[model samples]
Target chain A: MTPVLQIKNLQVSYYTDAGRARALDGVDLTLTAGEKLGLVGESGSGKSTMALAMMRMIKPPGRIEGGQVIVDGTDLMTLSEQTMLKARLSKIAYIPQGAMNSLNPVTRIGAQMVDAIKAHDEGSSRADIDRRCKLALESVDLSSSVFKMYAHELSGGMKQRACIAISILLKPKVIIADEPTSALDVVTQRQVMETIDRVQKQIGAAVILIGHDMGLMAQFVDKVAVMYTGRIMELSSVRDMFTDPKHPYAQALIRSLPNLENKGVFNGIPGMAPALLQLPGGCAFHPRCSKVMENCKTQRPPSTNISGGRILECHLYSEKA
Target chain B: MIKLIIRRLLFLITVIWAASTIVFFIPRISQKNPVRERFATLAISGGFSPKDLEVIIASYNTKFGLDKPLFEQYTDYLSSISRFDLGVSYNKYPRTVLELIMDSLPWTIVLLLVTTVLSFVIGNLLGAIAAWPRAPRWLRTFATPFILLQGVPPVLMGVLLLFFIGFKLKLAPLGGAYSTGVIPDWSSLTFIWDVVWHQILPGLALLLGSVGGWTLSMRGMGITIQGEDYVNFAEHKGLGGYTIFKDYYLRNALLPQATGLALALGGVVVSAIVIESQFGLPGIGRVLDAAIRSNDFLVIYGVVLFVTIAVATLMVLMEFIYPLLDPRIRNE
Candidate 1:
């Protein structure tokens, strides 16, 4: 089956004061229908940038230097902003980082919803719009009264849910959620995560979940792709990757997690992700990898497929597919 | 709320009283006394004897109630103010200080109020447009020159522009609210045209300096507010421009501007003096300047007291209006 979202050899760079910072480099990924793929990476690993590039929402100083973000059959990179906008909220909805920040504080949430809903379908009637808004809120476990309240009145989790509701109201075929639950408290995070999972399943929309916490993403997503320094380090079924990861970096990451089944000291990743502007030669993660060898410095590894449909990029995976 | 109002009212009263107290004494404390100046002028010009001068001074002092103790004099001054009697102008010789102020009051109000509101509205709109993310750079390119012009002092601008635009270019009248040949008429059309013609110089002076500051401030407010989460939310929703303007820019920007306006109300009244004098416009500022020069104490006192009270009252009114514009303040 054709993928719902196809990103081919995507590269994004920003012209900052310090010079060109490669936000994403030669990254390739895809999401199929009803697939919940978690794009896992630390803060500067380009997960968020990839999502923004897909929507053609990248602002100045940041440019998608080379990329083709194909959603359904249309390539968004070639589309005009006006056409991209029609695609943006309707074909692929984006739940931005902070839900509260994604709402107009002075406007009623319902009015904002109607505005977003009508922007794509100008012919939508008030009654139908109101019904859709009510259903949207209800689908996310929010009461219809919540729509009357301004953004400031809602708790962090409720705001996130409301944003999610707005995004899913049009039943976009693909949803790019960038760190939706990252800012919420543990209980609220659980509730928000549950709501996202429930909604995506009910709508059967492809979800590109962007986050840094592997453990959290593992609990909710079907597949996981680990990123480092703007490059995908590993892509696999979450179960297999957790059970028997091939990449040393991925293995170290999973081993570093605090296991509730065993009492032990939990260690975070040894070093930070490489700075995109000053990335090391060859494999970017080689500097932090304990199993690093001399070959890892001069030669960039081609992706090698391993057990259970996993892909790893390392000198150890030097062989091509 | 009542206590707050009472407290504010008392504070305003105290400020006005302090203003009157200063008005009564600051001029008297100046190196030359009005009595001595008048006596010397008469003596040098060979008009009066020593006894005549002394008698004249005593009579004038007694008539103005200046012969009494300072506190008693203060009470009398306050009482007269309460009774709406601003006393007589010594230099103007016959007209009461109240009548002089009343005559000039309309001209100043027409110039200042109209210019202030115009600059504020236009400046803020331009500022908001200039700060928009995808807005054409031409907006800022065009707006910067106006802001630069606003920075120049109003008196200097008023005089220079008056010379260039009025005298040299001969586009408008150089001074006065109406032609000297035209008699003061009360017909609506005549009144409107007279006010408009008279407003030209002073209005330009006020707007040239003021519009820039308002534009710069409003642009700054716009840039800051655009970063606000609520504004970002609106952009994502792709709402209409007017809705964005009202909900995002106007709602957020008005609070700071209102607070500035409260202080402006006080500062604004004193500011027109230089421009008013430059234009030779019959306004409180020009009268106040002449009063200071001639040591016409009653007229000077009357102008200072009236402006202080007007400013104080406007500021109090601003305090009441602030809460409605700013939810944060209202909640407090």
Candidate 2:
């Protein structure tokens, strides 16, 4: 079946005074309907950039160099801005990071939600919109009175849940959540993640969960993709990624997670990810990989399918499968 | 909200009382006393004997309440304020301070109200437009002239406008609320038209002088709000450009501008002074100038008290209404 969202060889870069930073070098991601894909990466790894690029919401200085963001069957890159705006909430919705603060402070929640709905469907009546808004709030376990309240009146967790409700209000085919719970407490994070999970399932929408926490991603997502220096290092099922991560960066990420089963000092990856402006020649992760070969430094590692749908991009994995 | 209004009302009353007390004592504490100054002018005219002059001076002092003890005078002043009695003008005897102020107040109110609202609307609209992402290069270029205009003092602007537009081009009347011979009749369009025509230069001067600061401030605020995450979310929600501009961006950006309007309203009296004096309009500022030169204590105190109460009332109203405009402050 055709994927709900297919991003092919996406290239996005930020033009700064220093240099052109390759935010998304050559990202290729596909999310089928009802699929939950977690994009795991450290800061500056371009995970958030990919999310923004998917939504076509990249700000100035950050340009979509070349790419095809095909949602359902339509090529979003080819659509005009007017059409793209219409496509945004109806075709795909984005629940941005820092969801707590991502709301117009002066407007009431219901009014803002109605604005979102009416932006695409101007024919929606006030009564109908109000009903839908209350329904959306109720689905997130929020009281209907939250509709009358302003964004600042709500707690952080409520704000986040309100953001979730808004994203799924239209039941878009795909929802890109960029670090939705990173700013939340552990318990609130779980609750938010569960709400996202339940809403995604109920609406049958594909989700791209962008985050740096491997443990949380493992618990939340169906598939995991490890990214480093604007490239995906590994893509596999959550179970396989947790048990046997092929890529060196993925392995380091799993090792860094504090394991209660084995009490020991957590070992983090050595050195930082290469600057996007001046990436190392060949595999970007080679500098931090312990099992780095000479070829890993000189030649870019190509993705090789291991088994089932598992894929790895590393010189060491070349001879293993 | 009612509680907030009541609290603000109480605060406003206190502020107005304090300002009134200060204004009431200013002429008293000054080296030149109104009664003595009048007596000096009379003495300079040189037509009276010393004994006769002393009797006239004592009677003048009693009539003006200057003969009373200081404490009794203060109580009398306070009581007069409660009764809305501002006292007779020191220079224009037989004419009360209230009558003089009433005659000039309408002209100043018209000039100030028109110029302020016009500048506010034009400035904020221009600022919002300039800050829009798709704003044309020419629209952004609008900022340069406004920024330069903001740096130019209101007096200079008034003078320049008076010279170029009023004198050189002769496009508008230079001074007064109306022509010298025109009767002040509301029923006649010609008279009303002449009044509006007379205000053009002064109004333009005020508008051009003040529009820049509002434009600059609103532009800065607009640019900041554009970068906010909610704006991005609004865009992602497929909000149309106008909806996002009006609801998300402009609504959030206008909070600071609203606060600015309140503060600007407070400065209206001060701004009017320079503009009014420049245009030679029969406003409170022109009256104030004459009052200052002649040491008209009652007129001075009354005008200051009026301005103080107006500003205090505006601030109190803004303090109560601000939360309604910006829900973020509602709980606080």
Candidate 3:
């Protein structure tokens, strides 16, 4: 079956005073129907850039240099702005990071929801829009009374759930949730994640959960992709990723997570991710890798496929392959 | 909500009462005496006997309630005010203060209300257009002149407009509400047109001097509102440019401007003073000016009391209406 979303060799850059920063460098990702994929990385690893690029909403000084954001079969880059806008809510929905500040404070939730619905389908009657809005709110376990309330009236958790409800209102094929639970408390985070999972199941849409919490990613996503310095260092099934991380960065990230069972001292990755403006000549992670070799400093590592559909972009894996 | 309004109304009454009391005592505390000043020329001419002068002074004192003790006079003043009886004017004797006010109030209201509302609407529209992210670069450049114009005082603007537009171009009448021969008749179109024609220069002066600040404030607000996350959410929701502009951008940007509008409306009386005097219009400003010159304490107190009540009422009204516009304020 065709994937719900496919991003091929996507490249994005930010034009700053210092120089052009390669925010997203030749990244490729695909998600099949109802698949939950987690993108984990440190700050400035281009995870958020990738999410924005998928929506084609990059502002000035930030440009999508080259890419094909294929939602089902449509190439979003080639579509006109007007067409892209129409395609956004109907085909691909984005739940942005900050739920606390998302909705317009002056407008009622119901009015704003109706605005989104009417933007695509202007012919929709008020009763029809109200029915759908009520259903969407109920799906998130929110009462219909919240529809008349403003964003400030809702708690952080409720706002996040409302945002999720809005994202799935049109039942788009792909829902890109960028750090959806980062701002909530632990309990609220779990509840919101459960709601997202339930809603995704109900809608049968693919999910791209972007976050930095390795533990949460391990529990939530079916597949996990580790990103570093604008490059995906490793991609594997969550079970394999947690038990046996192939790339050194992935291993370091997992090692840093405190394990109650073993009670070993947490070890963090040495050195920082390379600055995108002046990236290292060869492998971007070479300077921080303990298993680095001379070839790692002079040449870029190609992706080598391991057993069980796992892929690793490291010289150590390349030699074995 | 009713409780809030009631509290605001009580606060407004206290403010107005304090202002009225201060206005009533200012001329009395000053050394200048209306009765003595009005007869200064007669005394200098030495045309009356000492006995005749004594009788005139006594009658003037009785008429103005100066013969009574200060406390009794104050109570009388307050009681009369409660009864809506503003005393007769000292300068324009035989004419009550209320009648004089009634004559000039409509002209000032027309001039101020028209100019203020027009400037606010035009200025905010231009400012929003200039601040829109997709607006052409040249559109922003148009705001520079208006920004500079904000520094020009309204009185100076009125004089400049009187000199250039009224005197040099001769496009409008120089001063007064209408031509000397035009009778004040409601049924005559010519009379009404003549009055409006006379108001053009002064009105334009007020508009030009005030529109700049509104534009600057609204531009700042619009730019800030554009950075809000709801704008991005609106975009992701497939909202059209117009929908985002109206619903997200303008709606949020208008909150501060609404407060500014209320404050500006309250200050209309203060602004009208300079514009009215400079244009030589027979408005409240001119009446107050004459009262001050002749030391007509009753007239001065009456006009100031009217302005105080107007401003206080407007402020209270704004306090009640503000929550309806901004939801964030409602909970607070």
Whose DockQ is higher: candidate 1's or candidate 3's?
A: 3
Tell me which residue pairs clash in candidate 3.
Answer: none
What's the ranking of the predictions by lDDT, best on top?
A: 3, 2, 1
Report lDDT (CA) for all predictions: 0.81, 0.87, 0.88
Q: Model 1 off-target regions past 4 Å?
A: A125-131, A260-266, A293-295, A318-321, B1-25, B31-53, B83-85, B186-191, B239-246
CAPRI accuracy category, model 1: acceptable
* Tens digits of lDDT, candidate 3, B196-272: 88898989988898889999999999999898888888898888999999999999999999889988987877788
Worst-scoring 10-residue span by lDDT in model 1 chain B = B323-332
Candidate 2 chain B: 10-residue stretch with minimal lDDT? B46-55
lDDT of 1 by residue, B118-233 (tens): 88777777777777766678766666877889778777888888889899999888887677788777777877687688788778878878877877888898888878766655
Model 2 lDDT per residue over B127-196, tens place = 8878888678887778668778989888898889888888899888878778988789999998889889
Q: Per-residue alpha-carbon lDDT of model 3 for A75-105, expressed as tens digits?
A: 8999999999998878899887889989999
| Model 3 stretches astray by more than 4 angstroms | A261-264, B41-51
Off by over 4 Å in 2: A319-321, B1-6, B39-54
Error of 3 at A303 (Å): 3.3
Cα lDDT tens digits, model 1, A32-149, are 8889998876789888888878777678899999978888878888987677767767788888787757776656789878878887788988999999999999999999998787
Best lDDT goes to which candidate?
3
- Per-residue error (Å), model 2, residue B314: 1.2
DockQ of each: 0.40, 0.82, 0.79
